[model samples]
Target: MRRQRPIRLQHGTSLHAIVLATAMTFSGASALQAREAGSAETSDTQVRLPENAEIQLAPVLVEGQERSAGQYTATVFTGAEIEDLGLFNSEDVLRMTPGVNINSSGGTNLSSVFIRGVGSMYLSDVTDFMVPMVIDGAPINARHISLGTLDVDRMEILKGPQGTLSGPWGLAGAVDITTRKPTRTFEGYGRAEYGEQGQALLEAAIGGPLTDTLSGRLAVRYSQSEHWVTNDADGAPMANPSNFALRGQIFWDGKQGTTALVTVEHEDVNALPNLLVLMPYGRKPSVDLTPGLYDDVGKSLNRYALEVNHDLASSRITSISSYMNASNMEIAAYDRKIMQAQSGYPSEFWNQDNGRESFFTQDLRLSSLPGDTITWAAGLFFQHMDASYDTPRNTYGYTSPRFRDFKSNVYAIYGDVTYPVTSALRLTLGLRQNWSSTDYDASFWRGGVGSFDSRAMSESATTGRAMLSYDLTPGTVLHARYARGFAPGGYNMYAAQIADGEPFGGATNDMIEIGFASESEDKTFALTGAAYVNWVSNNHLLAYDSGTYVSSVVNADTRSQGFELQGRWRVGGGLELAAGLSYVDARITSSVFGPSDGDILSGNLVPDVSPWSALVSASYETALPPFLGLSSPMLKSIASYSYVGPRPANPQNSLDLAAYHKLDIHVGVAQDKTEIYVRASNLLDDMYDLYGYAVPAANMAYGGMARGRTFVAGISHRF
Candidate 1:
């Protein structure tokens, strides 16, 4: 039987130092854009901005909010930037952020996210519910919510363990997705794109005020692309499928500073399944290489939110309440030839899994800027989440039909206050006290036999954050911080039926960081750097059993330490240079046990950790001298290389997945209302895999599929 261990916690370990070092170094660097939450302003630093006056404020868009930007190490990508890259999904947009790991299962509908190498218990495309997807202050907690890059004002990737703020699985981090809200003025934008490999995309968004207090916006996106890999067995290329999404929202700006917004969205996908990331195994056909196989997935999302705020004698009170429901269904298969067993019909080799998740959150915050030396915000929050999954045996009958359900309801009150201890030194303190309950149910069915009983578990925690900051000068600041985070533990559907006993484990993480950021607000250059160490006790990790290829969830002591640096500099006329580097050290500090008793994994590098990574980009865009067909202005550009370092495949830390490097170039022409652009990614066509794995005695087979050389042509129109 699996033993349950008490939650473990530590401090100032390897991962914490590494992350702190990186955050400090890049905090002032121009390479990363500061995330703007609420409304804050910062000094302007001109570096590598296009001379087109129209593109005058890229830096301002990134670093416009000085106070908010200085308080947290966050990154932001604007809508204009996403459109310019011709990205098909939000994953494409997130992959560029520092310390972020995004892997997709070859289709638009399935994607996985990892931050700072933390919790990674995901098996298929369904990731752990650690990161909350918030749109316009409404939390989205469903896998079916198609996160396409459409009608977005900006996206903020808040790093570090976010336990103190967002409870439950938010022990890892948070991703705030803010969509384009209705504007007071009539305005809208539309874009269309076509590219190699049979790729097509169309997007449109429009919004305007209907009355003094009412306004609305609607967005639609449709995309399709051909598969990049060709089946070696059937001499056929896996077909790229199609996906679509639609969203509509309306807002009411009530008199006396109150507002409410309602939103609804739906998305669908039809395509082939993901190619299983097998380690080095030769002469084996990929899942996509097989014939008579298909993956069909669908999603539905319904969300409603209401927000209200009022200014009283001494404080501002705000309330935001929302409800969301999401569902996902997938039918897929693995390597049939390799997985065949029993009757050899591959009956038990398939998976039919369905999931339903629902969540509701209500938050109330009160803030006051009583004096120049003191600024504070406090809030009370209540949330409820429920998720259930169903899985059935394949023809092989190696597994039984299984069912699992989980429910959680929580209440929390937290506050953060910043006090100026002196003219140059500031201290910030935050705390969140939470109370919650959890319940789990699991059972199995075999050959007209149903057996097993359900178990219920409950627990609660209080998490918090504390930090200090000091300004050495107007252009530089130094800070130190410590934080605690948490992840809810419950039933594992796959384990409940397969293992001798269902063991559900919870995890806790503690981190410490220190850093400095210095930039000349009026100059053409800036730099930011940080280092951190993080220690995780009962760190939940996913491991594969040796004999059967079946995977299980385990909790092991783990550590990750890393550092990062980013810089941006302007090189005279129309030339800009941006660069970044990251180093992470993640490894297992202890072993995990399966129901069978012996060690399942003694020492393994956790999955999805890229130890060394860097990106270097230099571009020069020149304004055409009013040439032929150029009505308003145009910019032509070429850029250098971007690099992603090797990642380890297994826990023993023996395999080294090859690194990747690619070059790109771009050119654009713009009129008053219309813009046209062309971009080439992977111009050099370097053959490298993003990840690789090893098969027992089958030789090392890597899973890096080259995107090859591709061209994207796109046009955007503004009214």
Candidate 2:
């Protein structure tokens, strides 16, 4: 029924040990960048940075006095840079970045981002991922990244287990997206774009001061696109997709150190599963089938947030509260093809998912100010999440409906302290005590198991981090860190047992990392590199039997060891060159599942992980020469080539997707605040298996793919 699983079925589904672990430090990241939101934790290892940097993606938080300047570089990227790169969506922000990537997951509303080969691949309402996404000061759905960046200030990505800094997620890593806040002075922005595949987009934002003490901002984005694929058999247009987002915010900077921010956002998305393609993805890939009563996938989300803080002479007090509600619906042919059926319209095998989700979180903390010699921050965090979904199937007319209801709560006390032991050496320590519990109920009308409320699952865990940083120079730093990662245990709602539901075990990572950052004296050249390994225990995986069309979830031990190198050089004459490389070796070490899978699946490469990834790019911006007899206008061009190595497609490791390269180029001419540009993604039009699976019994194969070779021209202006 599903490849990313969250679907009704799939035949399903790492570890290392350790003395020393790795903790990600984003200029002293606590709970990823969540610490940047309200906690004032500081480390001298990082120097203040400029706004436009590429390392700023992943799950992070940006707000409050706790937020520090760019350091530990490449962890931050500005909205203007995002626009310059032609990276419009949340998915592109991470996937296109170095040291991080996302596996194939176009068939569902959820996709996971992998950091150094450690991340959750399959996701559902009842399941939690290794990484989490945060916006402003509040935690929100990871999928909201689809909302685009028309109103964004910056994005921050933190790698490694970050449980010691926050709660509920971040067993692997975290990403934070900070939206643009109202400025003291009035400002406005507008952008419009049209492209291939019959697509159009519009974005607008206006913000300014409303009063002496209050400022407000409004932003909106809308996009629509026609069929990206054609039904081979009937030549019918299909796979239409659309998106819309609206946001409003108010910021207050009051007297006596008090400040507050209130935000509201709504986003809607509709898309066809990208998996509706033939598996082999031959030279001329096509669906090859027709006439199915299947519907597309849809999602809606609403979010509300409030943040308040009081700055003290030496310390700061902060509070953040957030609430989110989202709905997901899917009614599609699981097989992605039309087959002869007994009834009219051939509707017997379509799958339906009516899933709903809600999340609420609150964090309060007190900490020394940002520049304190021994900076420290501590906070209390709490969260409650509720999810319920109904999966129904129809055999011509008879329906077999399965329902699942799930609930979870988390409580945590986290703190971090940074101090300098020597003039050139800095040390940071952090700890978090997390308490969590879960309860779930399941129903299978077709299996005769009416409804079963299983036993509740609960546990307590302690995660911690330690790091040492040395200044190679003011612009250069070398660091080492150890961290313990954790994610809560939860029910595999889709593949759970009907009678005695079993919840997958929580996952943990003991990671150790050593890295260095350096730059030239002129600030025109920069370089960063790191090496690390993650030992994952109880990694949740999927196990599917092509013969039975059934799937189950299991836990296994695995390990991922990798390294990354990134560099940038701003050469003379309006030329900038940049490059990045990353490599990971992820392998399963143990197997525990017995029924659908057993010892046979052990010693396999982790599925959906690319072991080698690299990219190189060049950007040039120069003024037009007077020979044209025109006033000064700028000519800009950016080009990059990326290579992603192959990996196994499934838990069984029976098939491996081939390696492929992607090329992107952008060109624009501009003067003043207006720009007209054309950007081409995947210019090579290379087609390779993004995901691959087979039904041995039917002698059939299936997979998903990216939209290859598309061109878009756009104009943007600001005042």
Candidate 3:
């Protein structure tokens, strides 16, 4: 067994300072409570009506607002539910979504979201098969998805290919995040929290009408935390993460049922990747390599968007235009040794990469108003992306200094329609055609020799969807759907040594699914289930060639079949339970990058995919009995458990990770405009690995561990 060291804050910062700061911020805001009291209060009024006046209440809807009768599978999380779950970042929220898995190599921005066994672990700027992330109708890079979740109104996860509606990058699926909009009434909230591991958080948001026909909203968040591990080699904190975000929006309502909104957001983050430990299943080791090597990542993003909507007699027109600028810098030790052997240098070798990306997108769509017989929508999409990067070497000169640039343009047109054949049955169809072009340029120096390369590629594909749905009962529906989706192919900048004109080919998937959803009367219980088979052709797989020390993309065939079950039951008396289960059997059926003709990978499990996963949660909420003369104080308690089964770590299934389970609990009390809560994550302090990587040259396998037990206490005030 390896000896472990006590983890301590390196800067000698006291937790007392954090507590005092939180106390002061909350105390200072108390002065504004009096001014906000009147606006925050709820009142009821009654008035006498005319002799013949009549009033009726509207019907109550219990389902999620973002959900619709559709061919695809999706899950929606409301803002309130997000808050209740204590999710502070996109990574935390994504882990709770059904049929989804997340893996990170240590930093907040170095992460990937796998939807139903389809995702890329390589750098996003170089890969085409990525789970698209959309915020307020604007597409963003995957690296920016880890920004703190502030003032988000809702989040929707669309499963499977969303090509027809979400465009080219939605090859796996899409994550749609809607931020809070300006409200007609003045409302705001402020929060302060202190937690274990030197974690502190502050968040606030305000929204209201600025004028008769204009509204505005603003939100801000800041957080900081020390790393969970210690760098024993240097006696320094392994990972320190800090981030801040700000967002503002304005909405204008014009005459003739026309409305427009403009939004701007900015975020900055700095962090160190998680400390990787040699793995074969044992106690956390005291790593003794890579001393005094720069290991940090920094990222920043700025986004702006404008959306307009106009209502016609029986139709609506919508337009969205967005722009994003993102920049990032990373410095890390590529290889670490206990002592220099032959090389007259330190034990650690360092390298750095800096890059920038700019994106612009425009979408135009028209939709007819809902009708008893038919409803339809048609849209056009155009997007342009430009990315550039520079890599400089400081030690371990295995690769030469390189500079690369990539530019891409995508144009698409799509339409969707649904027609009711009878009162109990419906038919739906969707079609999309997309054309894309990419240009790449690179320059590198190898062994005192310089070389330059440039290439251009073009690709196009047409995808479609068909579905049939029928009502089995008043509150139950069954549906079956078939869909096809594709991802564009591009050149790999790091693989410039490869033969010319041998760029990777595009990938496509055809899927068939059958599902059903039902809810009991009074909304006490609800259930949804789906089974799907996805056959993917020319699937993109990343491979590292030791001979060249370069990573390249290859074409392969894969099959992913899975079944999902989700249910929620209200046990009455303010006690509720929810559970979700998924079984995914994803495997590679054929591969072109085999070691030998007789050793082809024809039935190997897909990497980073778990065969089984599950989540169970329970919550109880009730009114407290006159606590200190407080009126109608509410108390709530919640507990949740999640499991991730074993999974392969590499494409060849050479390494495996064992199963792991996690537990979280939360308790809170609220009265009037104030609330306080305590949350505990990984209560049992379970030790498990979320992901692993094998370095054949070093004869070592590195694993990323799940965070240990943590506790946090927070206070919030609403006005």
Predicted structure 3: lDDT: 0.67
- Runs of candidate 3 with Cα error greater than 4 angstroms are 1-71, 124-129, 166-169, 280-296, 335-346, 370-373, 396-399, 496-502, 545-549, 594-600, 696-699
The TM-score between candidate 3 and the true structure equals 0.86
RMSD of each: 6.9, 7.7, 9.3
User: What's the lDDT of the predicted structure labeled candidate 1?
Assistant: 0.59
lDDT of 2 at 312: 90
Any runs in candidate 2 off by more than 4 Å, and if so which? 1-75, 124-127, 141-147, 166-169, 288-296, 335-348, 395-398, 447-449, 496-500, 593-600, 626-630, 697-699
Best by TM-score: 2
- Candidates 1 and 2 compared: the better one by lDDT is 2
Q: After superposition, how far is residue 319 of candidate 2 from its true place, in Å?
A: 1.3
**For each candidate, what TM-score against the reference?**
0.85, 0.87, 0.86
Q: Mind giving the per-residue lDDT tens digits that candidate 3 earns over 527-550?
A: 778898888888776565432335
Better of 1 and 3 by lDDT: 3
Give the distance in Å from residue 251's predicted Cα in candidate 1 to where it truly belongs: 2.7
Clashing pairs in 3: 106-273, 106-274
Name the weakest run of 10 consecutive residues (lDDT summed) in model 3: 29-38
